[model samples]
Structure formats: C-alpha cells, structure tokens
Target: MTARSSSAHVAEVEGVRVDTRHWIGGRRVASDATFTDVSPIDEQSIADVHAGGQAEVDAAVTAAREAFGTWAAMPVKQRADILRAVADGVDARRDDLAMVETRDNGSLLRSHLRGVMPRVAMNFRYFADLAEQISHPIDEIRGHRQRVSYDPAGVVAVITPWNAPLMLATWRIGPALAAGNTVVLKPPEWAPLTASLLADIANDAGLPAGVFNVVQGSGARAGAPLTRHPGINRLSFTGSVPTAGVIAEAAAKNIVPLSFELGGKSALLVLDDADLDLAVTLAVEQFDNAGQVCLGAFRVLVHESLHDEFLQRVLASASALVQGDPRDEATDVSALVSRPHFERVRGFVERALADGARAVLGGGPNDDLGGLYFRPTILVDARPGSEILTEEVFGPVLTVQTFATEEEGIALANDTRFGLAATLVTGDPERAERVSARLNAGTVWVNCFFVRDLGAPFGGNGKSGIGREGGAWSFDFYCDVKNTVFAPHGWHAVEGGGDS
Candidate 1:
C-alpha cells in the first residue's frame, strides 16, 4: 500500500503538536508497548500510539476515581461554566480537529467541517446547561414530603467507536462530566488521534487533574481492562453487538450500570404515495461516510409500485458519487476505515451475487481509486435470509426489497433483529404517523434522515443493544437517582399512613 508523505501525517491542534500517548492525570503517559497508527486514506503510518494494557487502565481508572468526589460535589453552575469553556476550546480548534479526524477515519473533511465538528461543541454546551437546570419536583403525601435527587455515579468508563469518534464520545462524555462523573475514555485504535487532541482541549479549559483521561490501545489490551475494572461505576459503549455482549458480561460481574448504543441493520421504508425524489435522496444519503453509520438505512424497503423508479434514481445518484481522497473538497466517498473492513464489505457483495442477487449499480472495489475505495453498491433479488440482507455490513451497500402492501412494507422494515432507527417516507401525514409507530425502531425519521437534536432520545433496541442517551436520558444513565422521604414542616405523623 502507498503511504502519505511524512510531513502530511504529523498533526497539530491549537498550536500544540498532537501526541499519541495515553492521557492520564492531565498528562501524557506512555505505555511500554506501542503500535503504529495508520491512516486509511493511504494506509500510511501516522503516529506511534501507546498500546495501553492493564497497567494503563488501572492508572486511568484510579485517576478518575480520585477525581470523582470533588468533581461530583462541585456546584452545578461551576461545572456548567467549565463545560462551556471546553465547548469554546473545541470550537476554536475546529479546523484542526476536523482535519485530523478526516485523516484518521477517512471521512470527508467537508462533513467534519460542516456538520460533525460543530456538533461536538454543541454536545458539551447543551449538556452543560441541561445539567445545571436539572430539576425534580417534590411531593407531599400522608404528612411526608418526598423529593428525588441525582448523584454522580463515580467513575464512568466510556468506550467510543471510530466512525464519528469525538462527536459520539462527547455525546456521552458531555453528560457524564456535566452530571459530575469523571471519565476514562477508550477511543477506537483505528482513529485515536482526535481523542488525544480532545484531552488537551479539556485540560486547557481548566478541567481539574484526573477528571478526564484517555487510554489508547486495541480492544483486548486496553478496552477489556477498562470495562471490567471494579473501579468503574458506569460503562458506556457504542460499537458492535458482539463486543457489547462481552462488555455486558464483564459489567455484570461488578454490577456496573451500562449504556450501549450498538450496531443496526435499519430500514428505509418508502410508501407508494411517497415523493420519489425525497425517498431516493434519503436512500442515497445512506452512502454518506461510506455507509459506516450505525443508523444508516441499509435495508431499503420500497413499495412494489415505486421500487423500479426508486432504484433507478438511487443508481443515478450513487453512480455520480466521487470516490477519491477524503481530504479533497470534491470527494463524496472515500476508503473504508481499514483493509479488513474493505474485504468484509467486498465479501458481502460477492457472496450476494453468487447467491443469485443482481447488482443494480456496483458490486466491487473501484480499481482506479484503489487502496480501499469500494464503489457504492446496490443489490436486488438478494436471497431473503442471506447474510448480506440480514447482517450489518457497515459499508456503502444497499439491498432493495419490494412489498406490495403497506402492511407488508411495515412487516419487512421490522423484520431485522436490530432496530436502532428507521426512515419512513409517505405523502400522507396520518400514514407517516401510523407506519412510523408500527416500525420497530428506537428513532423513526419521517421523510427526513439524520436530523438530530441533542435533546431527543437516540439509541437502539433488540440486537441494536440497550439504553437511550440524550438530554435527560443521558443524565439518567450517568447518575444514580435517590429519593428522600421526610415529614413536612410542623406536620404530625399519622400512624395509619393516610392523609387526614
């Protein structure tokens, strides 16, 4: 594989050169073992990342545990102010972070600049304010006043995925920090650079020592120790289901509460009355980020009457997508995050074709743009129970399924074991409401896709994994709720426990 120039591989954020070592106790901590971090764009060695093991995990957890009490006890206003500062820091270094993330994960640079980078700041700002404003009403019943309060759940272990690392990490980290729990984050080894940069941003924003830490390494060496560590009070993970099951088993032994946002094989349902243009746009949009998104509508279920037109439009749009370097402003698609992922996605298409599926658009790699650039694929006539149709490929591939009736369409959309999100297209308001309700998904987008509000609940169901995290839902998972019951002022206790 070709490699990018050495000069281009070096990254700097906020005039401070990016460091690949683990960040513990507000300083860079190096592990004895190390691994070469590679970029997917040209499969080039970007940096030497410290491959943290059990010792590093223990140190990070200890730092977080030591910092927890002071952080949790701090006034909400003070914490909120610190978070607001962190948000500002992120915004100031937006360009650097966006570029680094693009290099590390092969996502379009424009995407990071326009949508993702800005959202990372918003996650912190929104959660900071929300945490400060959190309130629970008190009730007086049977001469007793009852009130509930939220307390930080000690040290939280946050494990984030690579596709949208910083944004998703803050999605959980913002709330965890706002709610006063210190965090030990294990960023995906494939894209760990930006996370290392984020630690600097947090420290510069006046976050106390040991409040936020990063452990860099692969799943087995760093992730396993962090997730299973007894010092961790809460475990939050966003990744594959198989990994979640392993983390869950580890969490169970220590009785640590878990918040998981796992994999999905979500469906996009287009009714006969739907606007064909809008439906096609949404379907093709799934190819964004090279279809590495968990909420992507990979299984597109179209009404039989409009399936042909929808597929034709999708092919036209997908064919026009530019597959090249993600750093290029005009590039619409880029390489898969790694070589293994590239082969895995290619295998899905190859097996589907061999199983009698017909490729409507693309079915293999784009040789001209080689390295790991796979052409956007659209497969039809796929075997019903084939892995290509049922599994989470996490690639730029879509399988078209036709249904004759609205009932059938809904049935097909809900057929998956994963139900993270669903997209419903219909001209009728009533139909959108009814059909969306019937779709077995945690979040149902009507007409529009990827429209996210930080306040809205976001997560998955079934094999998509468990828990909702956004707004109050995030605090609910990161904090432990405590209810207190006491007698009202000057009130006499009733032996019968009934109001007089």
Candidate 2:
C-alpha cells in the first residue's frame, strides 16, 4: 500500500488495485490511524483503511450541507442524467466491482457478478427514470386547488451494512441522490472498500463535489457522529436490531428523520398443496450468502402432511451446496464475513443443541473445509418460543417446525418479533392470497424467495424496519412533501396580501 497526499491511497490486493480512503468533497482523505482489512477467504490482510473519527464525519457532513442547496435546486432531469451516468459507470466496471466485493465480504463471486452487480446498476437506472416519470396529481377541494410537491431533504446520512454492501448501499443512495439530496454515506467497517470504489465511480460520472461523500470507519467513530450530526436532515440504515436501536437513539437526539431496515426472523411456510421441489428449494435458499441476509427464511413452518418429505428434500439440496473459495465461479457458499461473526453464528447453534434441539443435518463448523465455514444446518424438535425458534440466529442454521392446520401454520409464521419478509409455497391462488394476507410480514412471496421489484415498497412490519423505501415511497422519505394551494377562479386576495 502507498499513500499519496494529493490523491487517493492506493493498495494492490490479489492483482487488483483499490482505493482505501475516506471520500469527501471529491477528494480522498487519509488518516494517520488506520485499520487492517482482512479477507475472510483466507484470513489474510488485504489493505489498510483509514479509520475515520469525528473530524472525518464533520468534514463529510459539512461538504454535504454546502452542496445541498445547489444539488437540490438543480433541475430533476439534470440530476437524473447524472444518476444514469453513474449507472453506466457501474455497468462498465461490473466485473471488477463483483470481484472486489467477493474478496471483501466473502460472498460468492458468481452471485456478485450475475445478480448483485447488475442490480446495483439497475438501482440507479430505475430511480433515475422514476424520478423523471413520477408525477403528483393536483387535488381540488371546495373552491381551492392544491398541487402537492416534494422538495429535497438537505444532507442525507446513509449508513449501510456489510452483508450486501454495494447493492444495498446503492438501494438507498440511488433514491436519495435522485430526490436531489446530497448524501454522506458511512459504509460498514467490515466491507468498506466497495463503497470507496462507488465514490470513485460517482466522481467520474461528474457528480458534483460534496454531493456524495463517504466516511469509512467503525460505527462508534463514523456512524454515530454521522447519525447524530445536526446537519443530517434524513437518515437510512440497514443492520441488526440492537444496532438500529442505538441509531434510533442518536437520531432522536437531533430529531433527524430515519428509515431503517433491521433484523429479521422471516418464516417460509410450506403448505400442504405446495410443490415439494419448490418448497425444498426455498428452504435451502436460506443458506444462500451463508444466511447473512436479513430477508432469509430462517424459520420454516411446514404443514404436517408435507413435513417429512420437505425435510428430506431440503437436507439433500443443502448438502449439495458447494462451500469453498469465494473467488471460484463454481462455489455456491463461502466463509462468514469475519472470525467474530463466525464465532457469533457458531455460538447460536451450540446453544440450540445444548437446549435439546436436534440437528438432523449439521450442528457446528465444517471442520473438513476449515476456516470459518459452517455447514448448512437444519434443527428440529425445538420447543415453541425457544431461543433458537424465536430469535434471529443469522447463520446457515434453520429450524423446522410442524403445524397440523392452516390456522396453526399462520400462527407459527407470525409468532416472531421480526416481520421483514416471508415466503408461502402453495399452488392454489386463493389459498395463497388468503394465507399471505394473514401472515405478518412486510413482503410476502408465493412460491418464490428474494424476488424484488424496485417499484414496490420494501420494509418491515415490526422490529424488522421503520418505514418503506422504493419508488415514490423513497422520494417521500428523502423529500419534504408540501402542498401549494391556489385560489379558485374569480377569487380575490385580501387587501393585507392574504388569500381570500
């Protein structure tokens, strides 16, 4: 690694060059205190990243505040054009971004290249077009006409998680920038490099200085200050419930508006009429990304008639998942993000096993593969409302429970505190609609897992999240909606300049 004062600090990792510095006011800012970023694949040091503190947060927030007026005042079409250009930049460097994220976060390279990377570009493009096309109709009440408009909220602070760094960050950033709000993003410390790369892309796409700034470091140092800063007009965060609580407190201090997508213990209900193959596949999908996903179906409730068959098929599919090097194209799964995270996940399963839950498939680490790789685990016989059954383990461990009746199934699925997402595998359309409406989840999928459309509102119902984000909903959060009322035809203003 080499530090250049006038430019970004550059480092070479596995034949790829990456910028590792805080991006503020269209400049790369470095600090004397740095943290070593390690790759989860082999536990090797990848790069030295600048550890941001109050000073960096102050600089980023100040930049965003200064840029907010001009950015917000600019024509929406012009802003959309810039967003489209950023999308193009992301598309042009898709392969590189995928590779970097894979190494940084230990997610499969194939997933990033095929799914995550493309969706990242799509987020910008989708928001750009929506920003231009979305319109609010004028309303008439009594003798007055009112035109509702959304004005950009000044300085938005976007704090994202490491599970799906680039994609999730852009999910918030695209809409924020499209709404004409300048943003100061505090990327997760575990997978911060891709965010730096994104800043570079934004700058190259001609995003004006101070419009999009990044401050990279630990939550206590960078995130806390950014959340609590008075300059921040709006905030969005995606992480654990405990972390969200901390952020909620910080936001409350300044009364900064916040949108959160927090933890989930989402359930996948296997109805008696469901296709056994499809139900099995959906159950196995929970192990994708090593079960780090907040929307993952960690709790599986199966109808008694299909329980035996579903369990058998799910085990076979999970066992077939290839766990190895994340860089390999054929690899389906990889190591957890870090040693601490691995330990945390491992501890969850250990405690469950001790509590008498039966692990028919996997119970602990996959020693044969070694190094932070945990086997896809399936637990059963856990008592109702037990720790493993109710809490979010956030690992490759899933528990299977049986429900004898339709009412029982719905009750079991809605039992968790989290309502981020749920999946119902059923062939009957009427039953799908009936059961889906009753399930307490923000998103309900019928015979599908993780199918998302940018136009639809996305969020949680309970502890899963605070507010929705997507399409106009995103605009609503990033902007202050105001209605301008007009005097009816032939109406006259008062002599004091007040409307009659």
Candidate 3:
C-alpha cells in the first residue's frame, strides 16, 4: 500500500482490528507486551497498543547503539539537513498527525502546535550551527594555552509524558540525535498516536537506521529498564515529581546523568494595575489543554484591590468556555486525560469547597458529555495551603486567591514547591520587572501566560525540572565534553639522540 498524507487517506491495514498501536522500527510491530489505548472522553478502547516490554526495549537500545557510529559521525550540516526533511515530513502530514493526537491525547489541533515540526528543525539547526560556532580557540590560562571540545554521550533514554507528546518528544529527540547521541524514546502510553506519527516521519526523512528508536510502553516495565540499562549513558525524563524521583534514583544506581522536568503548580498574578480584559484572555488561554500542562498557571492570585472585579470577570470567561468533544471545531475546551483525572479534579474541588472556598462560577462536572466534561471551575478564598494551591491538580480547575499587597502577591506566588513558569498581568514596568525577578520561576511573562518560541531555553528551577531543552545548549544535557592534549612542537628525541 502507498503512504498517505492524511489520516483519512491512511489505507486500513488488512485484519488490523485496533485503532491504536505501537510503532517500533519501521512498522506497527506486534509485541508480546501490549496495552489498550482508551479515549479520555469515554472510557472505551480506541485500540490495543504494543506494551513493548524488555525485549522490544532491548532491541531499540541495540538498534540505537548500532546506528550511533555512523549517525553520530555524520557532518553536523548533514544531520541538520535530515532534520529539515523531518520538519517537512511532519508538516506534510499535519492533519493526519493532528487527528491522531487529538483522538488519542485530546490536543486542539496538530497544525496549531505543529511547533513540533519547526522546533525539531530549529533544535537540529541550532546544534548544527553550533558545529561552526565551536572552534578551537587558543586560550591563555595563567600563561598556559588550552582547548576544549564537546562530544556525544553515546546512548540516551528519553521518557516523555502524555501532555504535548509530539512537541516535548521532539524537544528531546532533536537535540539528543543532533548532539551525536543515539536515543531510545518511550512516549506516554496515553498518546501513542503521535509517537507512531513521529516514527513515520523519521523513516520518511531517511534517518539512519537506529539513530533514533521509539519503544511503546509504560514507566515501570519500559521506563525502569531503559533508565537502569547498563549500556545507557543518560536519562532525560518529563513527568511528575514522584516519577521523576524514581527515574533519578534508578539512574543514580547506574551512575548515569539524569535530566528531570517534574511537576508544577505555577502562579499567575493579576496585579492591581493590570488590564482586566487582558488578564482574562490569558487566564482562559492558560487553561487550554485543560490545564494538564507542566508549566500551567494553576493559582490565579488577584490583588485584593481588584479581587471582586477580577473574580467576576474570570468567572465570566470560565463560564463561557464550551466543554465537549475535542473534535468539534467550535469546542473551546475538551475532556481531561481520563475519567480518573476528571474524578480527581472533582475531588480537589470538593475538598476546596468544604474548606471555606466558594465556587462562584462552576463546581460540578457536566454529565451531559458523559461526565468526562468538567466545567472550567474557579474557586475564591482558597488559602495557600489547600491542595488546590500546592499540589499539581493537572486539571481544568483553577484556584483563585486574593492578595492585599504586592508583598502578599509575591509571597503567595513563590509559595509553591515548583519553579517552572509564572505569568503576571501588569501594565507597570517597574512592578512587572520586580514580579518577574521575585517569581522564583525559570520563565516569566508580563501580560502573557503560555507562549514560547522554539529557540527559548526552557526548564524549571526547583522541583519543576532540571536543565533546559530548547536552545543550542539543549544538547549539552545529552552530550559529554572531551578534551585532547597534544604537543605543540615535535619531541626533541632526534636532537637529543644526536647530542647523546
């Protein structure tokens, strides 16, 4: 059968009964390990995906190792060229990928965040450009000349989460392979569709066999072994704090370098001088993807001076969002990752409501869409210590707290254990700058909530994450530094022999 550019055009595999499955190597591999992919909107099987236990994981590692020699040794420009092809391939099949991702993980549209495409290209191009930028420069250190160079870390294991699977997965993949390191990626089981699509793109782009391999499975069976693999060099993970800890511990057992991007309950400040309209827009936008984002602004701290007005406006905006099927072109909101997640958010809201917090706008789930839909609920008077404030709810629920003074606002914002990203809607330059610095996050925005470019270096400061993964330095996490010392002049052996 011929390859198709759209999901609509994908020729149905003969006798293939599942809509969801794993892509290992160049095809939909049947594995002894298997799990069913269920839609979050309704707890129903979309397809049976490959569980990809140790055998498949070992095959991926071996394949990556075999490909490393040639792929890593290729000229940086050549690598960049292949990445460009990958970007184009992703674009060519944008709709197809978007449908798969939306169906599996509930993404808005594949094309909207097709930043995955350009990001991979840019990531590769950035490192490709670095090849020329990094030159042997004679440096005199205390009267001695020295030189330094960067080398690949050999084999890397990338463990990505469900949210933003394509984008985040590429963020890890592009840089790792570009840095001359081979990679074995384990995408979240919830979103194997995007992983499968990316595997297809890699093959279409003609990536060297095994330069980048993806094994489909969960964190326990697939993730633990890869992280603890004796042959693996580094482990890069994006998930929650608890999981990150487990991966870190396992990597530590092997003495492998680990890059972890953990949980976050980021804060969004609605300063007194802020424009209410702008704040409302950003607040709603931040809740996109149902606030299942690592850098999501969960706590909306409004200055008490504007507390009444801000709460009223935000509640209005939240009420206006139509939560339903993600496939609907007009649906502004979609269901959470699963029924348990929806139930979990409901529980958090219930606890907050009982703790003197009042839900002025939305509190209950919309059972109309089969209970998978939860209204974009907002709570007022939620204290800092509440689970809604500290823990990563990772749902559409937003906790609104009031601050009487800028000091209170700053304190409340910094109260969380996370330092991923923060948003402040303020017109005052002085105040914005102050808030930006004291926010304690890796990235901050004034009048902006959740937007970033492909070139930005992004990571967390505290338990949020370790190391960044967006710019040329992104490769640093996946690479090793090597230095070679050589004699500037030929040895005096001949002259000494003559003298002797």
Off by over 4 Å in 3: 1-28, 110-138, 142-144, 484-487, 491-500
Tens-digit lDDT track of model 1 for 396-434 = 999999999999998889988999999999999999888
Q: How close is candidate 3 to the true structure, as a TM-score?
A: 0.90
lDDT by residue for model 2 (333-431), tens: 788999999999888888888988999988898898888899889999997888998888878889999999999999999998889999999999999
For model 3, the local distance difference test gives: 0.75
1 or 3, greater by TM-score: 1
lDDT of 3 by residue, 23-128 (tens): 5444555667567667675655566667777877788888888878888889877887787788778777666666666767775653344544455455545655
Model 1 scores worst on lDDT over the 10 consecutive residues at: 1-10
Ten-residue region with minimum lDDT total, candidate 3: 8-17
**What ranges in model 2 sit over 4 Å off?**
1-8, 494-500
The Cα error of candidate 2 at residue 448, in Å, is 1.1
Q: What RMSD, rounded to one decimal, does every model reach?
A: 2.4, 2.7, 5.0
Error of 2 at 347 (Å): 0.5
Between prediction 2 and prediction 3, the one with superior TM-score is 2
Predictions in order: lDDT:
0.90, 0.89, 0.75
Q: Residue 44 of model 1: what lDDT?
A: 80
The TM-score measured for candidate 1 stands at 0.96
RMSD of candidate 3 to the truth, in angstroms, is 5.0
